[model samples]
Target: AYEYTLKAEKVCEEGTQKQIPLYDHYFFSILICAEVFKLDSSFHDQAKKIAYKNLKNLKKVQTQMPKNFRSRYLLAKAVIKMNFSPNLKKEISFDFLSVIGVANEDNYLHIEGIACEIYGRFLKDKGIHLDGAHYLKRALGLYERWGANFKVQAIANEISNIQNDDFNKEININSFIEISESLSNERDLEVIFKNILETAITFSNSLKGAIFRRDHNQYFVISNVNNDISHYPQSIIDYAYNSNQIVRIDSIFDLEDFSKDKYFTNNQVRSLLALPLVANGEVESVLYLENSKVDKVFTADKTRILEIISTQMALSIKNAYLFKNLEKLVSERTEELEKKTHQLQISSGEKQTLIRVLCHDLANLLMSSRISFKRLNKKLKELELSDPDITRYLKKIDSSFTNQSHVIDNVRHLELAKEKGFQITLTTVDFLKTLTNSIDTFEQQISTKKINIVINENLNDIEVLSDELCLGVNILNNLISNAIKFTFEGGKISFGLQDDDQEYYYIYIKDSGIGMKDQMVRNMFQDNIHTSTRGTNSEPGSGFGLSIIKSYVNKMNGDISVTSKHKDDFPEESGTTFILKLKKAV
Candidate 1:
C-alpha cells in the first residue's frame, strides 16, 4: 500500500498528468481527497465522487492484501469518509458498527483506539450516552494513549464546555449569603481575625506575621515561627509604620542599602520582605517575612509568589476585617435594638401598670361620678327650675365619663398582654385535656356571644410539652373570639390536632373570621404597632388578644403564621387561618 500510495503521492505532487483515465485510481483518488481537503474542504466532496467510481478497483486488489489489520482498517477509513457523502451515518446498521468495532479491536490497536474514540465522540455529540458513560470514558482513555495532543485537548474542551453549561444553569449562593453567614457568628470577630493571620503566615510559608489596627493603635503578633527567638526586636514594630512598601530584599547587603538611605532598616533582617496589609482601602499594617539564614536568596519567582500570596492574604484578612467591622455594626445595631426593646419593655410595663391602676381607679371614679350625677339629678328634679345650666352640665359630665371609661378599657387590655407576654412554663401537659379545659373556661364567653363552638373528639388524646394553661388559653381565646367576631350567626368554629414531620404535635385553631390584609401580616406580632380594625359587627376590644397569642407562641419556641385569601389586587375571601407549629413532646 505504501509503495503504490507513494508513487501516487509523487504523481500528484508533480502536478503533470496525461491520460486522465489512468490517474483516476482508488489509491490516487484518496491522495487527491486528502490534498484537496487540506487546501480546502469543498474538494473532498468532489474527490469522494471520484473515489466512489473506483470501489470495484478496490475489490480487485483485495486478493493481493496482507494478512495484517492495516488493509481492513484503511478500507473502513475510506468508506467512513465516503459514508459522509449525503449523510450515510443514518443509513448504517448493526453490521456497519461491528465493522468499525473490528477496525478498532484488531491488531491495529493504534488505529483501532482512534476509531473507538471517534465512535464515542459521535455518540456523545448526538447526546446518545450508553450504559455507565462507557463510550465517552473509553474514548477519553484511548485518545490520551494515542498521543493525539490536539484531539485530546479538543475532547477535554468539550467536556469542560458541557460542565460549564451545567454550571450556568445552577443558582449559587450570592454575596449576601456570605454576609449573612458571617453575621450568624459575628461576635467572635477577633478569633476569626487571629485565625486569618495564622493561616496566611503558616500556610503561605512566611516566617512570621502580625496585625496592627491603625485605628486602635494596637499591634499583636498573630503568627510567628521565627528561628532566632533569643532576642525579639522591638524596633521592628516601630520601623514597620515608617516604611510603607511591600519590601523584599535578596541579602543582608541589600538590607544595608535600604537601611542607609530608604529609612526602613531600623528593624533590619538578613533577607526580608514586607508587604502592606490593606483593609477597606487603608493601610492597616505591614506584613513582613524574614529569612535569617546566610546562604539562600529569595528568588524572583519566590518573591512574586509571595507577593501574590500576600495579595490574597491581604484580601482574606481584609474580609475578616470587614467582617469584624460588620460585627461591630451588628453589635451596635443590636445594642441599639436591645436598648429600644428594653425601653419598649419598660414603657409597656408602665402602660400595663397604668392600665391596672386605671382599671380599678377609673372604675371607682366613674362610679363615684355616676353617683354624684344621680344625686344631682334627683335633687334637681325636686327643685322646680333647678339651675338649668347645672342640669346641662350634669349631662355633659356623664358623656365625658363614659368616653373616659372606654379609653381605660382598651388601655387595660394592652397592659395585660404586655405584662403577661407569652408566659412560658414548660411541663408535660396532656394536649387534649388542657385544650378541653381551656375550651371549658371560654364557655361563658361563647354562650354570651351566641357563637357555636365545635371541638373534635380526637383533641382529647395527645400530650404536649408547654405551658398548658398560658399557651392553650391564649390560643383558644384569640381564635374563638375571632371566630365569634367574624362568623355569621350560625357559622362554625373548629379546633383540630395532628402530628407533623417537624416532630410536633400541633393544635390548629382555625376560624371563620374576617381575614386580614397582606401588608398587615408582617407587623401582626410586633409591639407598639397598631394593625387592627373593627370586627364584622363592630365589637370593640383592644386588638391585644392576637398579639398576646403571638407573644406566648414565640416564648414556647414555636411559630404561628396566618394564611388568608388576601391579595395585592383583590379583597380576600373574608376568613383567616392560624397555623401553630409547636415543639412536640418526646
Candidate 2:
C-alpha cells in the first residue's frame, strides 16, 4: 500500500493539476497512518497538526472530490488511524461503510480493502478476538500484494499491539493448570459465565454488566451485578436475535432511530452491546453487557477482553451439554442391560431343571433296554433249533440291538461337543461340490418324504476356509433336513454364496417352508427350543440342529439371519429367507 501511496507523493511533489483530487486524499490518508503503523507517538504532536491541516484541505475540495475515484481506500485508511484514537474516535463515529460510500461507484478495491479493515477492527474492538488477528494478518498480505503499503503497515501495527496484549494477559503454565482445576467446581454454565464476566468487568474497571439468554418461549436474564432486567420486553430480545451479531450502541442519540420500538425506548439505557453466544457449532443464547452511565461506547480493549472470555464461555457450555447427554445415555443403557441380565439368569435355572429330567428318563430307559436284550438272547440260545421260528426270533433281537447303538452314537456326538472346545480344523475346499454332497447324503430321508431337493444355480466358483470334513457336512445336514422336514414335497430349497471386496462370502440357504413368527425368530437360538409345527408328513425333529449351527458359526466368525413371510399376509411371496455370511478363502 505504501508503494501506491509513494506514487501519490510523487504526484504531489510535481504539483500535477490533473491528479490533485486523488493525490491529495491519498497523501493525507497516508500521512495520518505514517505514525500509528510507522510514525511513533513521539511525533504525535507534529502528526496531529499535519492531520488537522489535511482535514481542512480535504473539506475545501469535498464538493469537487472525484466521484469516479475509489473513496473507500481513503476511508479505510482513515478508520485505521482513528480506530484506537482517543480524540479522532470521538470526532468521527462513522465506520468503514460510512467512509467507503462517500466514493461514487466503480471503485471496488478501495471498498473491499476498507471492508476487511472494519470487520477486523470491529472484532478487536468488541472482544471477539478469535480469528481477528489472523484475519488482519491475511488482509495485510493482500494489501501488500496490491502494493498498498500504507494499509499493510497499519494492519501489522495492530497485530503487534494485540500480540503484546496477549502476552501480558497470558497466565503462567502452572497457574493456568491450577485455575483449570478450580473451574471443575464451577459446573453450572450460567454461573460460570456470570462469575467470569463479573470478574472481567471488575478487573477492566468497568461499571455494572448484565448477560441474557434466549430460551424457547422465554428470555432468561441469567447474569447481572445489582438487580434483574427479566421484566424487559421481548422487542429488545427480538432485535438482538434478528441481527444475529454483535451490536454496540454507545449513545442514546445513535439509537433514537429505534425510539418507535417498545424495548429500547423504555430501557433508559445509555451504552449497550449484544453478542451472540456460540457453542458446539450451535447458537444456544445471546450475551450482552450494558453500562447506564460514564462511557458512551465499548472500547477496543473491552472488546478484546470479552473475546477471550467468550471462548471459555463456549467451552463451559459445550462441556455441560456433553456431560448431561452422557449421563442420560449411560443411565438408559445400564437399565436395559440389567433387565437382560436378569432374564438370562432365570433362563439358566430353567435349563438346569430340564437337563435333570432328561438325564433321569434316559437312565431308566437304558437299564430296561439292557435287561430285555439279555433275556431275548438267552431265549434264542435255549431254542437251539435251525427252524424258521428260531431265525425270526434272532432277527428281532439283532434289529433291537442295532437301534439301541444308533441312539447311543447320536447322544455321544452331541455330548462330546458339549465337553470339548469346538475345534475347527479349516482347509481349502470346493464350496459348491461339498454342499451338493451333503444334500445327497440326506436323500434317503428326503425321498421318504418325497421332497424335491434343488441345487438351483451355482453362483460362482467360491472357495471358503472351513472344516470341510466336519462343518460343511454338519451345517448343510441340519439346514437341508430342516427344509425337507418342514416344506411340502415340491417346496424349493436354494443355496448360494457371493464374493466381494472384503475377501469374504455370503452363504445363503433359503427354503419355501413354514415361516416363523416374530417370537419364534428370537427364540430360535435357544437350546432344545423349536417353535414351528410338524411337517406335511408329520415328521419329528430334535430342534438341536439350529443351536449347534449358531455355535459353529460363532467359532468361524460368520453371521446368519432369516427373513420369512406368510401367504396369508402376502399371497405371492411366501418363502423364508436365510442368509449366512462367511469369509472367503485366500
Compared with the true structure, all predictions reach lDDT values of 0.52, 0.56
Candidate 2 residue lDDT tens string, 1-586: 4345446655674775546665455544544454444447675554455455555455545446545433633553465456336355534435544553554244445455555565566656656453345446546655776789888778766765664454334322222222222243343656665665555444332334655665676566766554355444345556666666666667777675466666665667666666665554465556666655434435565665555445445444544444455445545644554455456643544444543444445445545444544553464356353456545544644554454444444344554455565566777777788787677656556776666655546555777777775555456666777777767677777777533458667777777776666776777767645443566577655455677676666666676677777556655666676666766787
lDDT of 1 by residue, 471-520 (tens): 55556546666666765555557777644665775566666566667767
Model 2's lDDT to the true fold? 0.56
- Stretches of candidate 2 off by over 4 Å are 1-422, 456-460, 528-532
RMSD of each: 27.1, 31.6
In terms of TM-score, the best-performing candidate is 2
Candidate whose lDDT is highest? 2
